[model samples]
Target: MVQTVISVAGASADCPEWVLIDLQGSLETRHPVPLSGRFVGDLHFTQKDVPILIIGHHILYGKTVHLEKPFAVLVKKERSADTSMETDQNVSGTSYHVKALIRRKLLFKTRPKPIISNVPKKL
Candidate 1:
């Protein structure tokens, strides 16, 4: 019997996929989604509203959990991850900064999606 489910990764292109749920109230994944009790407990207790793969007995739904970061924040975070240099930039009259946040309870980390902003910058 499974009491909880936690998904570390396996989302593709922001698309929804189907999964299988067992009669034991446990979610099943084809690729063994870290079902260890310790891991799931840590994740559930720590990460608020973490994306989980639900394999129901008759229904499967694909869902994703976001860190509540704005689109601009995600872009800036990725740009900063690429380098060790200062991420503060003053383009045109706006200011941009990048920051990385790690959950203190879960060992797994989530990075923002890589986005290429088409906004023209002042040369």
Candidate 2:
């Protein structure tokens, strides 16, 4: 019988804090383009510790929610299996490591409102 072996990567030394943002409505762009590395919006906190997200001319009210269970972000580790000398032991498969841990999220469930007043050029 043939068997497959999978290897697991080690945990990250520094577990960065990760927060999930839940938007009720979908974002529609004028043109179909990649949103990666693009400045989406600004997140501000009120005196009561509420979250407000301002994108374009729309403003969304949100609140912070604590997750019941935390999530771990995993990243695949790249390694070369080639060796100068062949050995009886075989190399393990690719592995992944925990990049970050998420314990909280910002939830925006209400509909966004258009900004009627003048917005500041810079915050």
| lDDT at residue 119 of model 1 (Cα atoms) | 65
* lDDT value, residue 63 of candidate 2: 95
Show the colliding residue pairs in model 1: 20-55, 21-55, 21-56
Best by lDDT: 2
Q: Across residues 1-123, which tens digit of lDDT does each residue of candidate 2 receive?
A: 222333333554556889999999887678998877777899999999999999998999999999999888777654456641352334334446677888999999999998886766764
Candidate 1 weakest ten by summed lDDT: 98-107
Model 1 gets an lDDT of 0.31
Residues 25-114 of candidate 1: C-alpha lDDT, one tens digit per residue: 343566866767632211122165443332222222223333344222111223334442553343222223422222222112232233
lDDT on C-alpha atoms for all candidate structures:
0.31, 0.77
Candidate 1 Cα errors over 4 Å, as ranges: 1-56, 69-123
For model 2, the superposed segments whose C-alpha errors exceed 4 Å read 1-14, 78-93, 117-123
